[model samples]
Target: MIQDKFKRWIAGAAAVSCFMGAISAGAAASSNKLPFNDIAGSFAKDAIVRLYNKEILSGTTESTFSPKKSVTRAEFVIILDRVLGIEPVHSAINPFKDVSEKAWYYDAVTAAVQVGLADGTGAHTFEPAKAVTRQEAAVLLVRALNQTGINGSTSAYVDEEEIASWADSAVGAVRTLGLMSGDENDQFRPSDGMSRQEMAAVIDRVLQNVKWAAALNKQSNATRIQMGWQYGQTTAQFEQSVFQAKVTTLSPRWFFFDPNGVVADNADQSLVTWASKNKRQIWAMVGNRSNQEVTHQNLSNVTYRGKVVSQLTSYVQKYGLKGLNIDFENLAPADRASMTAFITELSTQLHKIGAVVSVCVSPDLGSDWTDGFDYQALGAVADYIVMMAYDEHWSTSPKAGSVSSMPYVNNAVTTLLKVVSAKKVILALPYYNRDWTIAKDGSVIASELTLVEQDSLVRKRALRPTWDAAVQQYTVSYQLNTLKHQIWVEDGRSLAAKYKTVMDHNLAGLAYWYMGGASPDIYTSLSNAERFYGLSFD
Candidate 1:
């Protein structure tokens, strides 16, 4: 089936996303030797020896490496430059007065400064000889790696209150990257100068990090390895954005209106031609969302089911379509056997002509609305079985909670994987959020929120949004008039956590619900998600 070839391509993409280590692959191995007499039995001896072999660390003299010496700002910058393979671009106009052209490390310092790896202490003074603080080294390493969008707070450290205002995120990033650790007292001494031995160990960890991030990173091929949902009416909205490049497959709500097997008004026929020209797989959606009587009637009668399949087959041939998304929702429980028969029949007919079949079902946890779905039967026939993996809390919900809490989603996926093939399942995620307003009497009211609107509301209400690690969603609470409002917002962090569910289960990919709702930054988050998850999907 060429699944092996596809997996190999994905592996290659993942390898490229990881940080390339200081050592080049295929290079001859060097002999490990202790440069300093005092480091023979030291805890950092191995790290010191490795960096020395890479020429990233050096001795104070011919016979002894200064294992106890404090690393200066200039020395750290030079080490970072070498380890990251940053070529020092020689510029004539010096940014700092203290750094002279004749200085031995002038090129390294200038290169570091140009790329924002290092900066002056104050008043244009580049304190080259000053000892590099733990915080300073963290910032330098983060910059050297070109990592961005890292959010951190002092609360993560015991002495976090001591961390400088500017170094909070830097310290957080370094800690998250596993390059830095706390002391015996469980304190991150941000102001303390880093010793030469400690520097060596950190750099050694950075070298190992290259392998770690690469190993976990899986590059996704949007065409075969990823999927997303679209509203046919807003095809023009997402067709031109960077978000389009992040998704491999598009399932537009193309045909979900009448029970007579007719396509919906929301269906955009032109998307079929556009998808063909762009080499994208367009799966035309077909189903009934709320009208249970129509769905029951269509599935119960053999004559009507045949007609429905006939109409869909015609649409596929006429449009040059890639596949079909069966989104029959809210059907009666009595239609269980009928539902399975319909899917089996549709798959059999569709596969004859090479068009794929994907069935979207509500999250199954013994709920009445989802009891009729025969996951085992559908999973066997359908090419892809999508789990509408959200709606823990809807607009008319009683309590305010996460729309798709990570724990709930994880449990649902875990259970589904037991009955379905992981390779054929897709987890559908919500791109929007719900805001709940609570009156003093404990009554709750909710409204839908786009990510952009959520951010604006956070600012307008002057509320601090706190990340709930358990759920992977953000929570903000505030008082307006006599009512207390609480919003559990969804953004990049929550989305990445949701995507992890798919990866953890080795599922086909994810399907985002309705485009044109998320902010522009969500696109960057999705594109650069490899960095966050340390994954690669080619």
Candidate 2:
């Protein structure tokens, strides 16, 4: 009997009134300046006034709201249609037998039916004049918002047992979201008719929730501005380099693994304070030191994962951090699923506190070292995916070349694009270079050089640097201490070329490996509006 009643309520509630011409007709006939006399000091007055101003609801007859009167099914449907800005869909035949072709709500009902917002009562009867029950209202509003309530064991109402099974989930969803509430005694009275004033309050809450959700989505899609901070860098050292970088976001290497879940290093507590004062966002990076054993021991266990998530959440709340950058690298191939699971769990916890998640992943085509990173799954959970597109030619490489060569970067980016969205991918650039010493016995040794050192070495040694167009970096070779030395330099020209690829791909943004090593000219070139994606960081 209860199920049958719920079915009838849904069928009748879903039947929409013809809304085609009612909106403009109501608009022309009503004015927000015309206030309701009875609701002057009522609790729902503010909500009623707000809806009236938005042209979503009107008084029963211009100056009277009839606040205590039950709202009819057709009236509730029309209010929802107006507030949701659902345009009317004209139909030659009405879906419900009781609905008349000439009725003012005829088009509104058709519009609601078209969007699946409301339906007919029986096989063909709409029963348009029936008063809307609280549960029916909850179901209609949840459907209009494109959500289905998640079934749960517990209910938000004290009289949960009285709610029809079909409407239980909708009731809970509406209540949890603060879109709808119980009466003074905390009784839902799901089957009871909803009054005009109660309906007004519900609509107001829905409008506010929709607007807030849109703002959060916009923030999630905004372009990222990321800069890496080297571990152990002093407050003064980080700040000095940051002044030159002129970035809006920072990822300080401040958190790492410890026997006690995770440990945070302030590096400089003042740096975090300074970042907040300057309106900069900090995504505190948590690394596993690329240790396979450490990652497995911590992330694979359910208890350990929970503990780490709790610690990270507490840290973020304490410091008012904007985001988390998970950099747990060098995991065993078997730990792939575990790593993805950890990220999923961490993201869920952090998102509850309104913080973003970014995952730093190594670039790979099909290499074993990067096979452990489930790119697709991580991309789904994280707000951004940082592709460390450097070290193509590492310090241990037999032959020295650009750390991130053009060919290597192009291939890595193209492959990653196949898995992740361009909007969520951040391309990391090398801000320094490698210095290689060639042995006389036809062997090579490599070391890193800052941008300033690259220039000094070239001029002081009178070594004429030649541009390697294929690789897109400057290269030079000279003798030092009886052994020949070769240098691959990353400067303004090389940085600009790489940045162009970022623009060509329409990537989210650029990131630097570390702050201190780059030339000042690199910043000058990046700030140019004409050449570099029209960016003016200053």
Candidate 3:
């Protein structure tokens, strides 16, 4: 594996991700030095560029990566996602009860649970959204390294004077993994949440692990990694990380569907066959929701053998299907608790048949959607939660905001954790953008579009491009004679930045809005994920 190439622990272990371009293999990674460039002019610019080139911590926009901003839980998810994207998404491993068929990170959460990327804090609920404390992050980081086949146990927290005794192992793990070594003072502040700069450095170090993992996966040409989903609190840097995981996972996101009886698409069949043979975990969406009210009535037509359950069972027996992803959207609000119930039932059924269950959730907490969500109950029912942190800026909203801002995402996550668990949480990032239009009457409507197509409209004069600062997107204003319109389109750089947020907070993984927008360049970001952690393919 890529992780085996380097010493299990770096001596100096400088803040690796803090300096861009520092993660490239073979360039000596030094330790115990000022990891960043503080030069006021050109030196600073070079420093930033170095880190950017290495795919460390690029800023929010093309010109700046706000090195000083605090790294929130969502932001952290992106960082980890980027690194894990390169590894193989594991087959459903751990089992969390709270994560349900409707939870967003269902796929990733299940995989994380199986492989130990996410550990239940108390109950089975994987808090898909919540801020991560320093110690919590440390523990997760250490565990992630272990998952990558790195077999060293870190030092125990011995009241290192910085943090309490309980977190000594976590702190040591982070340091030993080469993610970071505290200040020159020799104190590992286990309780302190990491800073943006600190996180950048740590994420970079984790990337090295991912790199190592990837090298190992590539050693045997026949061994292909599987990719799935991850959800996070923000969209900015998380995008990059999601893509990175794809490469690391070496699998494609299954067209997670909500078919009841069966679903056998030519495309799906091909992917499923590849996954089955390779022991890969593709998305297995449940047509019936947690509510068990029949999430999709027409599923029987799409089932493998006329029934979704039968199809799934057949797949497991014949194809070695790894896990199941639930994408049951737009249910009656009254069905909320039932949603969890449905997943519980499904989990029982799937488990009886030997498959993992996962669900996609909105960025909004369970309160946001009452119909089919009892997050705690759902998490209890399934393996993980895919916190779909998108649509913050709806195409059809009265007000405009970032589709998934760090602030909003943090709030959403905080609320979610109150109801769910963190270990099994899988934060999601939007791979697409929302374009909005404003009418003279203050009416707003928006649509999801790809970066290239959105840009094309601007270049072709179909729409004028204007920058929308509130949402951190480029909006074009035009009076179609009398009506005004605006659109939010995502660029490669912006998407890359958004994807990193998934890793910052240590979520199991991330998920995308859909599969079509992903191209080769966007996909390459996952190339470095394997070295850091093992992806739960289920």
Query: What lDDT would candidate 1 get against the real structure?
Result: 0.70
lDDT of 3 by residue, 1-538 (tens): 4333222211112123232122332222222122233322332344444444545344443233456555554345434543444322221112234544344344344334323355555544455545556776776676655533433343443436656555565666566556656555555566666665566556555444555545434543322323343332233233344344342231233333344544443224554554445443555444333433455344323332245555555555564555667766676566665455556655777788666776777755444354456667787778777777778766667885567765666666666677676666766666666666666677777776654455555556644333333544444555566766555555433343444444444556555655444444344333333223323311
Worst 10 residues of 1 by lDDT: 17-26
What TM-score, over all chains together, does every model reach?
0.65, 0.57, 0.48
Best by TM-score: 1
After superposition, the stretches of candidate 2 with alpha carbons farther than 4 Å from their true spots are 1-224, 264-267, 529-538
RMSD of each: 12.6, 23.4, 15.9
Stronger candidate by lDDT (1 vs 3): 1
Which order, best to worst by TM-score? 1, 2, 3
For every model shown, the clashing-pair count is 11, 17, 147
lDDT of 3 at 161: 66
User: CA lDDT of 426 in candidate 3?
Assistant: 67
Q: Say which prediction, candidate 1 or candidate 3, comes out ahead on TM-score.
A: 1
Model 2 lDDT per residue over 1-538, tens place = 2223223322333333222112234433444443566776567888887866555666565356778889989888877655444434333334356877566677567666543467777646778889999999988977766557344332556898998887888888787667787888889998899998899888888766655334212312335465665544566777777777777777788788766456555534677899878777888888888778877878888888788888888888888889888887677888889888888988899899999888888887677788889998899888889888888878888886778877888887888899899999988888777888877676667788766677667657755445566887657788778887887766655666677678778888878877776656566545421122322111
Q: How big is the positional error of residue 379 in model 3, measured in Å on the Cα after superposition? A: 1.3
